[model samples]
Target: MPVAGALTPIDWVTRFDELSARRDRLGAVELDELGLAAWFLGRAAESERAWDDAHRAYLAASDPDAAIRCAFWLGYTLGERGEAVRARAWMSRLFELCGSEPDARAGAIAMLCRSVGAFATGRLDDAAEFAERAVALARASGDTDTEVLATMNRGRALVFGGRSEEGFAYMDRVMLAISSGTVSDRVAGPAYCAVVASCLDRWDVERARVWTRDLSAWCDAQRGLEPFRGECSVHRATVLRLGGEWGEAETTLVDVCSRERRPETLENALYWLGDLHRLAGRTADAEAAYRRAAELGREVQPGLALLRRDAGRLGAARTGVARALGATPLTGVRADLLAAQVELEVDHGDLGVARRAADELRALADTIDTVYLAAQADRAAALVAIATDAPEQALTLLRRSWGAWRRLDAPYEAAITRMHLGRACRTLGDEEAAQLEFDAARTVLTTLGAIPDLARLERLAAGPDRTPAAGGLTRREVEVLRLIASGRSNRDIAHELFLSEHTVARHVSNILAKLALPNRASATAFAFEHGLTQPA
Candidate 1:
């Protein structure tokens, strides 16, 4: 038996079982409780029905305020469930009930709904304005739920609009309210999840890690809280992965992937699972997971590209990452895509494109001001420096990046940085320093089973001359293959490589023949499949 207002959805659901037989006797208040309990328990259809019933009950009882509340939840939840038309109908009903100029509480909820709609459609300014108005109205009406939720919405809008520090301050206030029990369980649950999600979207891993733990605890304490549990697990798995707890992250993701019914939640879990598998060099498993996530409408970008790269499909990796970056508009998401672009371009020996990408990533990192994004930017810049004969610059950047990764407790990323540090040191003629970095990186990669990276490190140590060409292609043939994969014609290749068109055509023919590819397209595919973007 929980206290009156501290929600225990399981207890209410049990009570619902006994009273459902006599549901006709239940009034608006009782029906409202049942609706909330049903929603928290993941019974969406039942929850909607009960909320509808409660709305009608409130109407019959001549309580327009209460009815408006029910309609708001119905509209919001319906929108979330992808029933946009039905959601609009409910919102229409709410507005009709409001009758042009409603009282403070009802108007606050209406404003909150508007804010949600605006945020969903990428109207950040409108969303923030509506949320601010909602907060003001809710505070005036003494509606803590509306005020807290509106504050969260405003924070998200601010963050997405690239005002990261201000947005986080607002979100921090909301969390403080939740921690102090100034908000109800219903409001607190979503607020906790939303703020943590915003932190993740901005690459504020430390903040997200902290809030996710708190959210998990909140869900656990609620016993039968179901709607938020899946999202909580997804956030937790992300934190685990970032902290280098890959095994635990995999377990959590696999469990959520199997059990979560929500498409978005399940998609995230599967994507993260793919990322984990990719790091471990389980290419087949990673591909399957990424494919499933894509089927669920997830844009599996940087992870998929990195997977292709690890599998030695450098041409395909670069093309995929470039496409993803072009389509993505969100700054935080673009930071990730740009980082991948930098890595791919560097590997393809396109130093100019890589440098531009690194510059963009550094700009984004400065704007976001998060340690994670900062480290990513540093690592990207270091890669470009390493490729362009700037070992001193690369070493400086790598040191900062390695320290950041260490502070973040991300062992795999730190190890990768160490490998790059070794390259920079060796380039600077510090053989002793290079050896130490290589040894440390090798040990960590071996412990983590990072097979692809370990193999790359071994090849690096063995020197460029020792590396073998893919598909028996000669160095010049591989170079021609790379140009072909980039959509370059024989004329372009001839112009770029200072050869006759006939000579370029001959090289292309040799490339296709060596790789057993039927035509230029197949040749391109082979180039991608075997990572023959550049000669060894």
Candidate 2:
């Protein structure tokens, strides 16, 4: 067998496989090295087998401390693979071993493992308590690996418990230590991933961007760092997607999915691939990718609903998003679902549902205090206001939404908000302001190569120019006239169009004055004469 120090992780895996085939006996140390090689190669089953062998070997050799270490690694790998019950069982064995041996390092590792299991099961208080004990024990034993793991768990618990700022601050300190090389390579990668996950969970994109940079640098410094490199690539790809570099992001995600062996990493990359394809108007490709992601046990949500909306299946989109929102509680993903619900409900002309969704989104944003969620809430509110003929209120909300999106450096969303702002301004008779907003939005959409959005915006901007010259009636007035000609009352028109009855009345009076008609019957005759009424 090759000496562990003489071979790289990949080389060791090959050598170990050869040795296994030859039926060569491995010492406890060699078995542990084999496990490490399997882990670095992303072969979880192989890693677990090697670790189990090493644990048995160490116990037979009367090395309780070595056995405990093996148990900890086995537990960590199982937990990462989402086998929580198996992971907890291994951790319990570690605890029992530590009890007999009374070693501080073993006790700390046991506590950290238990804490992780507790956190996974949603016992945040128990997680925090166990993590604290682990940190204390690790510090006393001078075990930096255990200390870092315990600290990360504690920070995660705090973040999930609603102390985001404090949790992030603590995690930042840990990241700083990793960046400074104070933490070992064994712990650095996991720490970086944990912090990135926490930032993503909280919708702290700016922080995620910063840490992704650091993670990329760290990965570059280590040659052939298999599993961590795949994870770092995932994080960088997410940041790229958020920065509007869709092509690059898609390439990166595809590469990661091709190279990564872990189901979780592959699942996330596939989901992101679907998002990029959907955003680029490739519906078939997006659907295929979403299906693959779902097969990997990922939830295909907001993206799938938005894709259906883009395909003009608004009813299916509404049903899908509404079902998702109804089943999910208020959380980060719920925020995204609610945003999709608002747009779908509004487009379906269910203004009451849209208004309720907006209100709920606003309340959730206020409770979470995330800039992204707040911006989404503002956008939803603006759409509801515009539908209700409250142009002034819509304008205020759109501006707030636009500012937030701009500050978040999300150009596409900012451009969408600007388009809405333009419509609000036009409704309020501010033609110059409306034109400027439209121009700005057009530039962004063009630069981003957002073909569908640009096409939609062009159609909206052309509506006024297409107005019939008989009496200079607006598009909305024409719509109201058509509904009048259909033998619909004002209340019926308001209900169908998602407008207030008062707004419908005002549109009727405007239609009468513009067409120089005396009443609804005359306006109906004019509409039919102008060929504005639908054919039987």
Best by lDDT: 1
lDDT of candidate model 2 versus the reference: 0.80
TM-score, candidate 2, is 0.83
Task: Summarize candidate 1's per-residue lDDT along 301-395 as a digit string, tens digits.
Answer: 88999898887889889888888888865666688899889878986748788999999999999988999999999999999886655677899
Candidate 2 Cα errors over 4 Å, as ranges: 1-34, 53-66, 100-103, 464-466, 469-536
- Write out the backbone clash pairs for model 1: none
Q: Which runs of model 1 end up more than 4 angstroms from their true locations? A: 1-15, 19-21, 465-536
lDDT of 2 at 393: 91
Best TM-score goes to which candidate? 1
